[model samples]
Target: MAKAVWKGTLTFGLVSLPVALYPATESHAVRFHQLQRGTTDRVRQRRVNERTGEEVPFEDVVKGYELAEGEYVVVEPAELEELSPGRSRTIEIGGFADLAEIDPVLFDKTYYLGPADPATAKVYQLLVEALAHSRRAGIAVFAMRGKEYLTAVDSTDGLLELRTMHWADELRDPQQEVPDLPARRRDFNRTELATAEQLIEMLSVAWNPDDYHDTREERVRALVEAKAEGREVALSTGAEPEATELTDLVDVLRRSLAEARAARGTGPKGGRSGTAGGSGTAGTAGRPRTVGAAGTVRAAGRPGTAGRSETVGAAGTAGTAGTAGTAGAKGGPKRERARRAPEPPEAVEDLGSLTKAELYRRAAALGVPHRSTMTRDQLQYALKAAARPRRKLGKAS
Candidate 1:
């Protein structure tokens, strides 16, 4: 059973419901022991009093804050209680705002609130049903552990969910940090714009929470478990590779978008393969067949100074092309057919590495529109701009 961390009243006008708050989530981070590398003995923390120059009982110690050099203000339990944010015994909800309007960075810890008494279950159910019908949540202030919390209270399945938020002062001003966009921007051509639109149409689907996974963390845990079991864990190189020549963006967009849209339904085992393709010629052709190559480039585009750079072009031939001997027709091995020889590796510029078609296809994946005529630099800039994660405000003190 989940344990309640707090018991409080939900108050808005005369409507009052006693609720117990329980943490809604738990961290799955790996724990580590501090140990001497040579001895392997775990290190333990000790408590010592400064003035007495002796170890002190854990129960005797009190929380203190330093105000001046070598000066401190020690507070007793009673004094601490007196200074705590005691005004909020009740979760007093004020109003509601569109969930999408929230910056997302403001959201912190989440707590689940349920009726404190079985008799008040009806009240809890009422709130949940009401919120579902109204499509609104309650904004409230609450307190726990002597700290005040600004939170959003929403009801779902007979329980109230409380998500704490950071203060306004905590959000960083991005305009002050990032540089202004270049003056001479490329304009989108009809084909580029049309393909970009088609890609969006292909990939568009209603949000579904189930369509996600933390593959990185899962892979890490799998490796950790393998090591713990004394098994040899080989690093995995994801997927096979092939190469195609860069072609028109229209076909690429169409191919990509189609796959994305097809992923929406309750159909295939894993929509990992389906999606609308971006519109363009040789849409998916002329590009590296493996996602690994493209993934590396995208990951490298972050703020840090470039440690290295990769250029993609025609690479060395990947063995024989369609030299198959006829098998089925004459009850023999199938005959190979003629195909374009794989291009040899050439030092292509970063811009050259991705064709206009490839750029539009990628821009479609990222939900950036008007991509057809977008220059390689524009495409790169847009990708970086769209991939920004929500900024967490005021890291916990």
Candidate 2:
């Protein structure tokens, strides 16, 4: 088990519970040591005095704030300690807010809060249950390591999760830094929009993180291994493909939607051949294809376009049915059957009624991807979408 990083008491209203904070996440990125290019000697950094050109002892190091260009106010360790706030062991909750209201950008680091002693377990569970039932997170200010942090405490997986947050003033507006952003709205063709929506629906599946892989890390490791074995490694110049200019938006969307449906084994096989610009060309079948923002198709697939053999599973079927019911209301008997179809379980309907932690648990159970980083609303939407049924596509006349 990981060791606790902080020990403190959590207090709200008249209740107090002893708790210890444990880091909830860790980084596993590969590390490299600094060494001389030719020699194996490890590179080392040292602290030295600029004036005396002598090494500085760790104990003698003191912090200084620059007053002007050449002047600094030197602060000693003892003086700094005296100026610091008194160490407080209590984390006092100030107020509570709906978890959805908190912006995800503000969250920094997260730590799990565990009961410090067996005696406090009951109180700890009480707080967790209260936060979960109320679907609210408690806001608090905490001081640690001589620095104060704004934090939010919420219940997750039956435990308390405390996340430090950036101050409101720390956030920057992107519009101020970004240049040449579109100022005026551009109208989109209705058919193009409908096609895009269809493509999204066709490609939509339960989030399974295992389906993704970090190829960069694998390539990096391979390069390192090849160099260690004294084997030749060929490197490629990183060049991006030239951008394509789009003429017809609706045609491109239709082709792309057809391709996506085909990839998933729902659309017709064989490519549609036509002029590159006004009438887009649907390249050969069974290839990994992408429809660029400019509506250009980059096709590289096999001979025949085969339907995707993967099943949507039970959760996916539920999500697809729900979605189809909402979209196919105008279709005669099918619409009535869809309307009469059972609604999603009460738990799903009351998603907003549960805490973020409970929502996360539900997402995990439903195989939602990236649940850890998803906002509450995103999770709810994904769950709702996953519970709906996929729409059936008709063959072209």
Best by lDDT: 2
* TM-score, one value per model: 0.58, 0.68
To one decimal, what is the Cα RMSD in angstroms of model 2 from the true structure? Answer: 11.6
Native-referenced Cα lDDT, model 2: 0.58
Task: For residues 1-397, write the lDDT of model 1, one tens digit per residue.
Answer: 7899989789766788898989888877767789988998999888987787799997898878899998898987666556644444688878875443466667888788888999988888888877655545688877677777888877555557888999888766765555772333346455545555544544333222233345467778889899989999889664344543346344444443323223222112222221122111111322332112111111112211211222222221111211111111121111111222222212123545666555555555554532442445555555444343344332333
Model 1 misplaced stretches (Cα beyond 4 Å): 48-56, 84-88, 96-101, 177-194, 236-397
Per residue, candidate 2 scores C-alpha lDDT tens digits across 204-303 of 4333344344546667888999999999999875434334336645444454454444334333423322211222222222223333222233333211
Task: Return the top candidate by TM-score.
Answer: 2
lDDT of each: 0.52, 0.58
Candidate 1, residue 362: the lDDT equals 56
